[model samples]
Target: MLSLRVPLAVALLALGRARVVAQTTVKTVDLGYATYQTDASIVDGVTSFLGIRFAAPPTGDQRFRAPQPPATIYGIQNATVQPDECMQSAVGNATTPFRLSKRTAFVQNEDCLFINVHVPADLDLTSNASLPVIAWIHGGGYAGGSNGQNPAQTLVSNSNNTVISVQMQYRLGPFGFLAGETVAKDGVLNAGLLDQQFALQWVQDHISKFGGDPSQVTIYGESAGAGSVLQHIVAHGGNTQPPLFRAAMMDSPFLPFQYEYNDPMNEVIFANLSQMVGCPISNASLDCLRSVNASELNQMGQVIALDNLFGVFTFVPVVDGDLIVERPTVTLRKNQTNSDVTLIMTNSHEGDVFVDAAALVATNSTLAEYVANLFPRMNDSSIQQAVALYSNLTDVSAPTVPEQAAFVMGDSIFVCPAFYTLDAFPADSNWKGEFAIPPGTHGSELAYLFADAVPGLTFNNSAFISSFQSGFFSTAIALNPNTHGADDLKPDWPTFKQTGKTMLFNETTTGEPEVMTIPTSDALLERCAFWLSLSDVNAQ
Candidate 1:
């Protein structure tokens, strides 16, 4: 027998520009257990349903466990207000430039596993509108960030009401990424990744209720979010039956040192975390840690993460023997990826923000020292090879040792992952791009995509925004970037497989948009190949 819990006196008010006065009645969707009322007043043509709970609160005994579906709700829950972001942590005050402080300024809590949906206002819910869906996963090095950072209103409006955009919030910091033999045995390893997987499954089950086509789902993310996309691609050795997503878009996918579940470093981190929380490291540590307060555990995780040398996060995804069978490099090399179509891009200077400028200038750290610090497991032979490759770099972009260090960091972590992803997928089914706008620092291209939503971004080039959004929307709607809208002035983007060509997004000296395709530099490819070869030693 089927039991449905319907809300009583459901009244959804759609507001006009003022948002204070009711303009019309809004629609509601019944998700078997609960009914949600959406807000159609935030954007002009987009209706947003925010803070829809997908999983039960992961607090107390549920901490460190895989996400479970939400409990039954009895009434019409108001989903207009954004939920509290997942708890966040930073290394002192150095993260201001990356906007971590601003993004995480809101209230945070353990009951933070929520999903937001934005759809075209006029889409018919009764009819089979079946709009293509874009599910976004936020990035904060897998430690910090909220789904509210990048709003999907613009993307939905730009799609001409042809697409639906969904954003998901998952666990972060120690709550989401804690891993060791004890955690593996008692709690789930990669709980954060499992949260993402569960959210995608929620979309599969409920997106159609809002007129989305489950078959045309595209998973899009940037930075750590993009890395999460890659994790999903290689999940279960790319053998996930009925793949979660059909297409994927990765912007500057971050590939950090993916240590094994029971690596010495992870064991040390777990021990440190348990000790900090007053829990002895033993068979009962998992339960003991779970008994500790959420705030205390979060603070301890931040302390442990900051204890490491600058430029890296302590808690990140690990190579669990099950979900992540092996290093992503190994999976990608063997062509074991699940997604069918992929669009990948990277900034020209991905590592600038990650390198410690003060330490580089004061200590004059050698390129070898920088490399070793970032990848301690790397062997002497590989370190020498890396130093030989980057030390004498004469390129004007990376002339100094610090610049060279930044280049090594960028290539190994961001650029090479994009190249490897392109190589792993079918050439004809994948496309590549480079965001070379002035400075081209990591997350710079984000402004072009979410200019109105992201704070402190000064990008206002109308032509570039249209071109960039067109390319992204076309891929989501038609699975091809070249099929841009008529207003888009960008040229036809060629596939990476066809000519090894990359669509470079830049501006002319006079600040006009200069978007064109060029052959991917063989020199860069050579450097990435060298890095990929040392994946084993680097633990990537």
Candidate 2:
């Protein structure tokens, strides 16, 4: 991590936390274990309960391992006081407004596996109708982030039908993605995914208490969360073995989970453990690490010299073979999906916010410095090509560079991965692809979907935008997986073809879909296609 001492940044004292689902009126339910009451009057007429912990704290010996299932209390406990978030540093510098609650999410703790549920107040959870369930996993590159995201009161209120929207928090950073002989030999690659799987299992067992139909579950998420969704779908074969969710929607998902970013050069992931207890790599001792104090782990994470390396959560998801099987595309293509998992994969205009030149754009490179940057990453040639292409794209002043390169950055990392994922699926297979050009970046859809998109449009044209989203998604999900209904989410829209007919999600063109003509729209991208090809070829 950092030089063993954590630096304390200017910690802003903030309060006025957004109320979870505006105060509302709805009958509460007692699971005998806990009493979860509903707060209606949320912005979108939905009722929600905040801070529901799904599992016991993974402290002490349970450190750096799969989450243990939560125990049910003997009596009704007040389901309030949202669980403190998992250990994750906040991205205050992010162009998007994802908050700086705890620059490193001080809310984090060993006891961090929890789920927050929101539902339309209009429909009671105890009601008999089969309302759809949307289980969302938060995104922080498998490193940091919480279940209490932009919030889903709006979606629950506006959908006009009952929906159980649950957002969850999981272990992050070294705690979540730490991979080595100790972790691998113990049979866990992405222990974070293990937390997600258990959350789904929690839903199947307890959602009904909140009036959620486990059979009508739809797992959806953006960025890393979306990647986790796809991973779950392909990991255990559509959850059919036990059957957690029936459908899935992945938005700008991390389609392929890679490993180069975690080991050796970034050896800091487990440095604290080594300094305090765990034997070094030569020893492969996890038991030593397991006995270390949890607070010490938290302190170690905060001090980690990530900016020195590259941003927060350095120990991101890796191809460790246990939690993750293979690159997302490879796994799906090889082991056909047996369950009807409705697919809605998407991307945005600017997904890779940090792709800016000031960050890692290579220029006037020393060969050693260059090699050090992309060390051990398969082909050495592709590193230079990536640097050259990145340098060129960053040079927006050049007329030769198309304006669309802004979106292309996201495409290569986020959107392009989804494209590769869809292409891997059999043609004529159920799938939908769309892109949102709203004035925003990564997780920009959060405000539109959960919080407010355009502040001025509140109470006026809000219905139109809300209806558009509901119409589009309802239609796509129903038809894509043939999910027991013939209803369309919106008007005439074209299903994505091998040629990549992308649906445009904008102010004027909500449902009307169109094609992104790469031949003309992306002619300049050729400058980097060669590099990309080499990168892939070199990987193979």
lDDT for each residue of candidate 2 in 277-315, tens digit (9 for 90 to 100) = 445553355776676676665545445524323322355
Overall lDDT per candidate, in order of appearance: 0.81, 0.54
Cα lDDT tens digits, model 1, 232-302, are 99999988877788899999998988989999989999999999889989854478988888888888888
Q: What's model 1's overall lDDT?
A: 0.81
Model 1 residue runs over 4 Å out of place are 1-25, 91-104, 394-396, 456-459
What residue pairs are clashing in model 1?
none
RMSD of each: 4.4, 7.3
TM-scores for all predictions:
0.93, 0.77
**Residue 167 deviation, candidate 1, in Å?**
0.4
- Each candidate structure's count of clashing pairs: 0, 16
Please name the candidate that would achieve the greatest TM-score relative to the true structure.
1
* Cα lDDT for residue 379, candidate 2: 62
